[model samples]
Target: MQLLALQPQRLSAVVRAPASVRLVTPASGMSTYRFNKHVISHHFCANCGCAPFGFGVGPKGEETAAVNVRCLENVDLNAWPRIPYDGRSV
Candidate 1:
C-alpha cells in the first residue's frame, strides 16, 4: 500500500531529549555536524579536557561532521594529519 507509506516508523517525529543531558551554554558558531542521530556535541577545554569538534544528528536531523584537531590552537597543527580518533566519547 504505497510501500506501507515508506515506513521509518512511518515518518517519525517526536523530538525532545533528556535522559543523560548536559548543558553549560555559551553558544558560538561553525564546525557543525550531523550523523545517524543521537546528539553528542563537543567543544571541551574547561581547563583541559581538550576536544575541538564532535557532533551528531544526521540522516534526517541534518548536521554531522565528526571533528577533533587536538582541541585546536592558533591554527596549522603541522599541516593537519592526526588520524587515530576515538577521543574517548568526545
Candidate 2:
C-alpha cells in the first residue's frame, strides 16, 4: 500500500513517495512533528483523508521527524487498514 505524491515541491514529496500521488502541505512551518522518544506525529489532508507526511519522535530528545508511508501502514489497526486523515492545516 503506497500513497504517492506527484509534486516534488510539496510536503508529500518531502517524504519519499514511490510514485505520483495527491499532494498536500502547510503553507509554512514543519512538515514533520515530534511526539515521543520512538514515535512522532504525522499528518495529512482532513478533507481528502490522505497522508501528506508523518512526524516521528527521534531517539532521546533529538526531535521528531517524518516517518515513511510504510510506517503509517503499521499505524493502522483494522482489518481494512484504512486510517483517517485530518487536513485543517493543509
Candidate 3:
C-alpha cells in the first residue's frame, strides 16, 4: 500500500459530509481528543487506541467528517491520490 509521510502534526484525511457517512456501530464508546481545537472532535478506538476519524463543522457551517484512509478496509491504498498539506503551518 502507498501512504504519504505526513508531518507529525499533519493528518491526511478524507473529508465527508455528515449525511454521506453511515456508521455500522454506535460511536458512544470511542475516546475523543480535541488537541485544543474544540472545533474538531477527534475520535480514537478505546481498545486499540488508533484514531480512525473525527467530526467537525466545515467552513460552510455543515457537519463534516475527517476520515483516516489508513484505517479503512477493503481499500487499495496505493491507488489513491496523494495530496500534500502542511498542517503545522495552519
Per-residue CA lDDT of model 1 for 23-73, tens digit only, reads 344325333333433475544555655444444565476654333423334
TM-score of each: 0.24, 0.30, 0.78
Per-candidate total of colliding backbone pairs: 6, 10, 0
Give the better candidate number (1 or 3) by lDDT. 3
Model 2: CA > 4 A from native: 1-24, 27-39, 67-90
Tens-place lDDT digits, model 2, residues 6-62? 333232323233233333445143343344343646564455545545544334545
- Badly placed stretches (over 4 Å) of model 1 are 1-40, 48-51, 59-65, 70-90
Residue pairs whose backbone atoms clash in candidate 1: 33-63, 33-64, 33-65, 34-63, 34-64, 35-58
Selected candidate, larger TM-score, 2 vs 3: 3
C-alpha lDDT score of every prediction, in listed order: 0.38, 0.40, 0.71
Q: Estimate the TM-score for candidate 2.
A: 0.30
